[model samples]
Target: MDWNCKNYHTLDFELKKYFGEKAIKLSINGGFTCPNRDGSINTCGCIFCSEKGSGDFAGNVDNSINNQINEQIKFLSNKWKSNTYIAYFQSFTNTYDSVINLEKKYTQALNCPNIKGLAIATRPDCINENIAKLLSSYNDRTYLWVELGLQTIHKNSSDFIRRGYDLDVFNNAISMLKKYNIRVVVHLILGLPNESNHDILESVQYVCTKGIWGIKLHLLHVLKNTDLANYYYENNMKLYTQEEYINLVCDCIEIMPQDVVIHRLTGDGKRSELIAPEWSLHKLKVLSAIDIELRKRNSYQGLKFNQEQK
Candidate 1:
């Protein structure tokens, strides 16, 4: 049977191939803090980041890890009805802590019922040999993936966003994780403050050079109370329309390797917090548009991928 997303390597298809069934990522807030927000790197978080630390949909930080997992499972059961789960530490910098504390929290999630894998979302600068070794220890027991946020490869945009770390940090983190044979997923955002379409594709090209497992493509949406919101009103920043975003995403997929899983095509921003690009709140509508555009162009993922460039 032909898959719905025949062109792109969707994460759903990849998971089914490995797990032999559908698996859902249950987001858990590990009550973690980012180095940029804690004065270790900078006092202010990313300009577009929300107060929730990007864990807007994750479980309550006040809840115990076990409790959060159980409750989220029950809540999501109606939607997924799948028993297999990936414990996703989706909040702040998940690896910015002691190895002992990290192990304790990660072990608790892995031990939870129905959790077959662990996905830790973190900053590249936070990773080290000790943390890499600790995360590697889990590889023998369960499926483990490390997610790093590399919003853009452009230093200008990176500085504008106050990412707080250079591209070298991301390269080093990937090297450490690769040594342990751990899968790495990178997150990239389109329509950043000054990034052009060429810049966005350049970022995708850069990812191909890095041996990573997956990529999440996000649209830059302005949210209330964040620096981005203020920047938008004050500077009249441009936001991508739904049609523009769909076209750009399809283009990105075409330039990427077929084996690099498309972890996400767009982000589900909390409607109440979203301030710009109102169309982003219609996630399903936007996704459908991407499919329609892909079919219209007869495009499939990696159609333009250049192995020589890698």
Candidate 2:
């Protein structure tokens, strides 16, 4: 029920703990495209990406930035009354488009009547000094957070996942944002096809050393119409069960650096297109199961880890 574990703090629990009120992220798709999918970096996009580019489960394209923020606020506020929100640009590479267009969309969201902040999800290679400055512009008025997808730090595993960029890209992005005092929330997917437990733990350790503000740990889900789906269909891949995934997650958290914010402990799957990982269909159950086991063993995040991780 409580959100804090020893090493990590869930986003919802952390926000409530700090602000003393309920908070939510309003998922926004700002009509942005990715260089990888557009043939700038790679042609097929990341291996795990859905045909709709992963934010299809979120809001619609016709929903303007302001409209999405307002609709989410109306829905959340009616129930929580005093809750606040972060406009999360989640769909594609949010920062890949021209800075002017990003500015216009972000400005509309930030200036919306009820939004409290913004959370942008983009690839590591997409961030730059100018983008950092633009993000810093709203820091004084809003709680700005950037989420970079670093699925795994091991180069071979990254290549296997077809993450499109390397560890150097992630390092530069974090450093640039840190220079402007912009908070970063990194995303890493667990249970990747070929990664071992050692690989998973190593990735967690590497990300911890980068000094990010938060982390979103996800299990790789095989959605329909993607290369990963074909892998599953051809007997080349597997999904974790509820128990297997919980153990992996608990282990990752126990080794994660203590100060990181855990934005999510699991992923939300698009039920219609999902192939394996049927356990993800009941995300809340998975979380509750993980929490119970963590408590049972009296273990918490960073329980056996150190900040001086290499």
Candidate 3:
């Protein structure tokens, strides 16, 4: 797909077309905690998740939703000249609480000026019929999409990561979300412990067959204060080099369906906390490398897509 002249379909490219301009994501913390971290399921969250639940960039939870939105808008104004935003519930499990409380936080964001849409990120286990219906209602009114952190589909890798859910759970979550016509975005992390390139590609293929609206391919980062960091040092773990990651990202893009929006190929971790994959700190260079590699091979996203599986 020639999205904004890029090789793959991008969320930013699609949003630009929909909004007729740039519509940035305003990451907000909803003061929610994952079931895995609240002692209900397991006290230690997913092995790789950070102290902030992988949302180091999210707004402060102490502030009201509106205040957080306003503050972020003011802070972002200096960099982006956009007037619209998508309220992104990024911290922890956004849908873990009571439905009533969830609506309050979501409504508060939507009520704010220039909030063009909503994006909620949570684990598959947090979703149910009630949550699905709630999200569907918002989808009918405004731009909305739910992101499920199904980091890997393989049982061994999932267990090692302490994800606390199974493939069946993720399947059910997708079914419920799709039943209500709500768009779904699935997250997958590459370079997990003991996973091979083939294993990562299999997970990519598995997600593509689900007909999800979007996908986020994350480069695994071992950040400080997390179990993964300890594992890295003690075991002398091998993280992907910049070239290896760039090539692997391009490999993933080749199998992805043309219509599936790529929300992220890679992202930066909190600088001070990141322990491995130091090359990831140069985000722009990594991104450029992916594009350049794709061009060199005269290939683009979906060039090797096997649509029959879907």
Local distance difference test, each candidate: 0.91, 0.83, 0.93
lDDT by residue (1-310, candidate 3, tens digit) is: 4587788899999899899999999999999999999998899999999999989999999999999999999999999999889999999999999999999999999999999999999999999999889998899999999999998989999999999989999999999999998889999999998999999999999999998999999999999999998899999998988888888999999998898999999965978888878888888888888989999999998999987978
TM-score, each model? 0.98, 0.94, 0.99
The lowest-lDDT stretch of 10 consecutive residues in candidate 2 is 1-10
lDDT of candidate model 1 versus the reference: 0.91
Best-to-worst order by TM-score is 3, 1, 2
The TM-score between candidate 2 and the true structure equals 0.94
Model 2, 7-83: lDDT tens per residue? 35777777787667777778888888888799998989888898767786557778787777777777777677665
lDDT per residue as tens, model 1, 236-257: 9989888788999999988988
Model 2 misplaced regions, further than 4 Å: 1-8
State the displacement of the C-alpha of residue 189, model 2, in Å, after optimal TM-score superposition: 1.0
lDDT of 3: 0.93
At residue 137, candidate 1 shows an lDDT of 92
